[model samples]
Each structure stands twice: as structure tokens, then as C-alpha cells.
Target: MARKMLIDGEVAAVADGGHYDYDLFVIGAGSGGVRGSRTAASFGAKVAICELPFHPISSEWLGGHGGTCVIRGCVPKKILVYGASFRGEFEDSKNFGWEINGDINFNWKTLLENKTKEIVRLNGVYQRILTSAGVTMIEGAGSLVDAHTVEVSQPDGSKQRYTAKHILIATGSRAQRVNIPGKDLAITSDEALSLEELPKRAVILGGGYIAVEFASIWRGMGAEVDLFYRRDLPLRFVINFRESLLLLIL
Candidate 1:
């Protein structure tokens, strides 16, 4: 027998009066998944969200609560950029008759360590937010078992299953390496953020924001950067007016 279920104001036929472990089960605890699950829980829906274990460098089996933006993407990149921008700041300070006493040195280890600490702290904060919101936080990789069921594989070779009235697959995107020879030799933005030592020289291949941003970052940090792109100009899809600014910055 089938009964109509009202979900998000939509009526759909489901198994009549079927029992569910949660009202909503989200398969990824990335930004999208976390936001959706938290919102659903706020609305009195019993929500459970599953994510892979915490890791700055994401893999198929390892992602954290706050997703790419917080864990490895924007936050870390911005922190590095802020650190690199000090060089220009120091130079500009010279124009204001501010004389520096000693040789200015950038400590890569200290910055890297602090950045990692901030990331870990934010991970804990996200967990606390979920706990406060009444969203069950499950640490594992989740897979769809059926339309209304999810199976999670834990870190210790254990699996758990849960049924839900509605399932949300908010698994985020992953960076794809180009299908070229020696692709494995190239590091994605993920690895670029967590480099043990600052690069002395870097060659970036691509015209997207990531490539341009890295080029600027490395160059600002005193690395020789060469950017290669297939298009006549990098960021061809960006607004025409911003092209000149990007050119000057890069």
C-alpha cells in the first residue's frame, strides 16, 4: 500500500505509514549538507548528517564537517594570501618613512601550523553547532542504499544503516586532475594549501580563479610564477571590466 507524503510542500506517494529513523538523512556534511540538515532540524525534522573523517586534504574517504570552503579551500587560501600580502605592506610602509630595523623574514612553519590549528578549531565548532541544532552527526562515508535508506561505512570497518523519510545527497564536488601524462605529478589546490615548505618556483596550468589566485599568491610570497592557459586571456568568462584589473594583479 502507498500513501501520499507531504515533503517540503510537495505530495509524493511513499510506503504507507512506514517507519523512518530520521525525517531527513543527509549523505554529506559539506557546506550544503550541513546547512540543509541544520535548517531541516530547526523545522522540527529529525535530521541526521554523515560526513567523512576530518582532513584538510580531502579524498574519497576523508572530508570534514565544514566542507571544502572551510577545511581546505577559501579559508586556508585567504589566510595564506593575507600572510603573503605583508611583503607589499612592508614595502608600502617604507614610503611613509617607516624604517625597519631587522631583516623581515616569513616563517612558513609558523603560518602553516597556525592555519592548521584554525582549521581544526573550526571543525570542532561545526560539530558543536550541529550538536546544538539537534542534528545527529555521524562520522563516516555515506552511500545510498535505496530511495529512503543510507548506509554509512565507519572508519573502523563497520557499517550502519538508517532509513529516512527524505534523503538529501549533498556530497560536494572534488577536484579532477586533467587526463594527461604525468598528471599525478601535479598537485591540486588541496595539496597547494598544505605544502610543508613554501615553493620557490611554481608553474600553474589553467585560467580559472584558482590558477590565477595561486599565481598571485606565490608571486607575492617571492616565488617565480608562470601561468599557462589555453585561452587568449585568463578568466575569459569573467566580466570584461575586471579583466584589466586581473591582468594588473597577476
Candidate 2:
């Protein structure tokens, strides 16, 4: 069998005992999975970690390198948020006695374009982190073939089994869209970061931090935001309001 000298992959130097093949097999190449693999490898434990192809919009199917953070979650979300926050920063600059220009326009397409590029860059960086750590990085989805063994499905429909003393799952959380009739029209926080056009009338429903933050962001970007929560707060009906200032919940 021909193997590259610099190959940090599953095909290892076969030993007579094959006991040192892999001490750990990380099922998902997400944050916790990759971290665990690298840490174990660093401490003289053999490791192999697998992940799906790079995806701009991550689902269960097409999740990419760097896990949810780079492909669809934190990296893209933060980039868009940073891009959107400038609108407010511009407003605050005017109040700070700075002679800012008139009617600063927020280009959703441009911000989305830049965010996509930044997210891809971060994905590559994460790949480097895993590879440079001497942890064998496999590109595919892993399944439990047995108790101590896993079957990895490659991009070309090829299957290979890996055995390890320990198996780990680190596939991070995924964003879920609402299950309604018109749910297809609405995008989750993941797809929202890559919107082609700014929503003219944005309606957000939920009491979570993502919902609140997105509402604030869209409002800042000049969208007519109608935010709804399960419970509504009354401003004027204050029974000693200064005690715990829970203001403007929705």
C-alpha cells in the first residue's frame, strides 16, 4: 500500500499487534470533538476525527469544517452583527458631536458577501488547527458500525471502518426553523446571516437571546421590526419599577 510521508490520516503504519492504531475515534469534527481528539493525541494517544464537507448553510446534511461556529453559526452571525452594528455606531457618532455624513446606507448584499468570505476563511483556519495538531482529520460522516468501531461514509460513497478504544460525539448544536405552513419563507439565524435583501417588514417571534439580538439588529438596520414574545410587558404599569429593571422585553 502506498501512503504519503506527510499523511495524517486513518491509514496508519500497521503494527503486528495493531493495538496502537487509534486510541480514540472522534465521531464528529465539531468544537468539542476536534478538541478532544487533539488533546488525546497530544498526550501520546492515537486519534482520528471525521467531518462532513464545507457548507455555507449548515444542516444535518452539509455541515462543514470548523463545525457550526465557522460554517453557519458564530462566525457568520457575528460578522453580520458587526456589519449591522455599524448603523448604530454611526448614529452614536452623530450624538458624540462628530459631523457624520447624511443617511448612511446599509447594504445587506455587500455585508452578506463579506461575511461569507470571512466565514470560509475561518473554516480553513480551523482545518489547519486540527491538521497541525497531528490529529488525523477524516473528511466524512461517521456512524456506529459496532460498539468500539465506526463506519465512515466518504464523499464518493466509499465506506471504511475505524476501530478505537474510545469513541466520542461532538457534533454541536444546529439552528432549527419554526414548523409552520409558511416556514419555508422564513430563514433561521444561520441563513439570516447570508440574506440577499434586507427585510422591509421583519417579524420575529420568540423570547430567546437570538430572537432579541436579531430584532435589535434588524431594527438598527432600518427594518420595520415587529417583535412578539409569549408575554408582553407594560411600561406605565410599574409597581416600584426601579427594583429590577426588566424593561422592553419584547
Give stretches of model 1 more than 4 Å off: 1-18, 239-242, 246-250
* Per-candidate TM-score against the hidden true structure: 0.90, 0.80
Q: Which residue pairs in model 2 clash with each other? A: none
**Could you tell me how far off, in angstroms, the CA of residue 232 lies in candidate 1 after the best superposition?**
1.4
- TM-score, candidate 2, is 0.80
* Candidate 1 per-residue lDDT over residues 1-250, each given as its tens digit: 0111234432222577547787788988778888888888776777889999998999978999899999999999999889989989999999999999999998888999999999999999999989999999888999999988899997688999988878999998877799999999999999999999989999999988889889878999899999999987887778685578767768
lDDT of each: 0.86, 0.72
Best by TM-score: 1
Backbone clashes, each candidate: 0, 0
After superposing candidate 2 on the true structure, give the runs of residues whose Cα lies further than 4 Å from its correct spot.
Answer: 1-21, 233-250
Q: What is the lDDT of candidate 2?
A: 0.72
Candidate 1 overall Cα lDDT vs. reference?
0.86
Cα TM-score of candidate 1:
0.90
